[model samples]
Target chain A: MFQGRIIDTKLRKLSIQDAEKFIASSDFGASIFFSGTVRNQNDNKSVIGITYDTHDALVIQSFEEIYNEANEKLEIKNKAVFIDHAKGYLNLGEISIIIAVATKHREEAYKLSRYIIEEIKKRSPIWKKEHYQNSESNWLKGNPLVNEKN
Target chain B: MKVKIELFGATRDFSDQNILELSLNNDSTIEDARIEIIKYLKKNFDGNKDFVRIVNTSAFSSENNNIVSDNYKIKNNEKIAIIPPIGGG
Candidate 1:
């Protein structure tokens, strides 16, 4: 069985104790967890805050698709996935996204965890608006690495 | 006839406006509307061949994958959504 969840919440304060408790309920032998936090710097500019805006319907649907695809392609036993990203204003050091996966073996767990993060970064329809110290804000488009237009 | 075009993602940023009101002939197809949109947006946007997807009602049509013909009638006040691919961490 593979469990997956996508939520919008303030996860910066996500505690390790709570994560341990969630992992404790599972019978898997190995667990992998990943957290994405708001970085204070971007392209040498000091980012004061970020606002994430998303097409709610499409984002949720795309996330479900990614989750399903990861489960089908990864060789894992009794996997569980949890993702939470904030929707409104997020300050520096706030947790942007959290992913945790569990499996019976370490290899599969590690591989699947990395794969999910990559796919989400590439495919998800979420967009971010970054605000700098000078009170300037711009809506950034897509993955900076893959989607940058030449 | 008039049609409402709703923009999403980077497409909205390119347009600098979220909604566009397009006046078209009664027999105009969706493709015609798109061409006019492309021409209007070309003044502000650099890329002419930028790929975009259209959502009419609930159906999704990609500019590369789907074909819109003259038989396609866009009703007045109908809303069409334009979506561009979005990527972020």
Candidate 2:
């Protein structure tokens, strides 16, 4: 099973407990959870907050694509995967993303968790704008999207 | 003919709106739309070269949410989106 969603701050907050609950199961012996937090500093500047913008429909599509790719590449068929990302301004030390995986062993769980996050960063149409302490903010340059079919 | 493009991420600050409208000739391709967007960005945000670079590197996704190539024909009132570089965890 795979679950991916964007947590809109206006509606709800992204939480670890929800991710844990989604992937909890007696069928798996290992559960790996990864949470990406907004830190205080970036490029030596004080990061007061970050606002994450996403193309909602395309993002959901990318999530499903990533999950399917992980399934094929890792060869781990029976598993539970939960991914939730925040879609609004997050203060320092706030959780921006959570990737939880439950599999039959620790190795697949760890590999799947890492693989999904990396692929999401590369493929998903999500952007981050960092607000500094002095009231200045800038959008961080990210990996350019390249379509192989183009 | 005209096309409406939904802006996201860094482009949001440039236009100050989520959607941008561009006028084009008949049967204009996605490449033409890209050029028009670059012109609009340059004309409005003249001093900012960074945003222009974003336009150059961006991809256009059709209403169906699939990335279309530069040669894809543009239809009147077709809603598309300019997807800039992405970075998420």
Candidate 3:
């Protein structure tokens, strides 16, 4: 299964709790939960914060598509993919994205989890804007994984 | 034909609006539309070459939504988006 949400608030403790609850409730043999947090530095710069922006109509399909592709390519059966991405400003060390996956096998869970994160990086049309303590800002460069094939 | 291109992320800053209204020839493709947008950005916004990318309806929704190629034709009234690099996790 594929599940996703575009969260407008910072996610941290609550997101972890929710992920734990979700996997525990399932009968999967192994599971992984990944969180992408905003760090205080980027390329040696003291970053104060960052904000994520995305079109509401966009990338929702990207999430589902990535999960489905992972299921088929990884040969994993009976799996669940959950993704929650923040939509607005996030301070340093805040959780910007959370991903959880449950699968019938440990290896499959690990592989699928990595694949999902990479795919989200490549395919999702979500944008990040970084703010510096000096008030300079710029959009970081990103590329979709599928774009590499083109 | 004409299409309304939505601006997202850094593209919004370049266009100064959430949406960009541009016109194309009767059978213009996505690439053609992109050319027009780039031109507008260059002329009016001093846009540099390496800054924008296009994510069509296919970014999530359909098999038909291939990342636009030079010959990728566009349908009339289709919603196309001009976006900067996405930073989502």
Candidate 4:
């Protein structure tokens, strides 16, 4: 079983606890959780916060595709996956994303966790705007989608 | 033909609008649309080459959720999305 969702900060926060519980099962012996937090600095600049914007529908689509790809590539049939990303402004140290996975073995759990995050970074239609200390902000440059092979 | 382009990321912030409407000749392709959009951005932003460069790297997607190539023809009143670079964890 797997689930993917975009968490709107205005409505509610992204909870690691929920993800942990969602991926927990008696049958799975290994569980892994990964969380991305808004850092206080980047590229020699002091960051106050970050605002994440997303193409809501497309982002979900990408998440589902990533999950399916992981299932196929990892060859792990029995698994539980939970993924949630924050939408809206987040302060430093706040969680931006969480990925939870449960599998029958530690190796599968670790590989699946790593694969999901890397794929999401390269594929998801989400953007980040960093707020700096001097009341300035800029949308960060990301992996180009235009040159993708059709 | 007229089509609506939904902006995202830097494009949306630079344009300050979620959607931008454009008029094109009949049966224009995505390449034509990309050129027109870049022209608009260049003119409005007073030759901000950096922004223009970013928009040039963007890809357009049809409402059916496919990243279309420049050769894909546009239909009248079609709603397309400008997908800029993606960075999510």
DockQ of 3: 0.46
Question: Poorest 10 consecutive residues of model 3 chain B by lDDT?
Answer: B54-63
By TM-score, how accurate is candidate 3?
Answer: 0.83
State which candidate, 3 or 4, has the greater DockQ: 4
lDDT of 1 at A8: 52
Worst 10 residues of 1 chain A by lDDT: A141-150
Interface RMSD of 1: 7.4
Root mean square deviation (Cα) for candidate 1: 6.1
Deviation in Å, model 1, residue A77 alpha carbon: 5.3
Those runs of model 1 whose alpha carbons end farther than 4 Å from true positions after fitting are: A1-24, A143-150, B1-3, B13-17, B21-33, B39-79
Tens-digit lDDT track for model 1 on A9-52?
55444444445555654468888778887899988889998877
- The C-alpha TM-scores of every prediction are 0.69, 0.96, 0.83, 0.96
Residue pairs with backbone atoms closer than 3 Å in model 2 (clashes):
none
User: For model 3, how does the per-residue alpha-carbon lDDT over A129-150 read when each residue is reduced to its tens digit?
Assistant: 8999889987776664334211
**lDDT by residue for model 1 (B6-84), tens:** 6655555545557778888886766677666766656545434443222221122223323224346677766665444
**iRMSD, all candidates:** 7.4, 3.2, 5.0, 3.3
CAPRI accuracy category, model 3: acceptable
Residue-level lDDT tens digits of model 3 in B3-41: 887777766675566777888887887667767776776
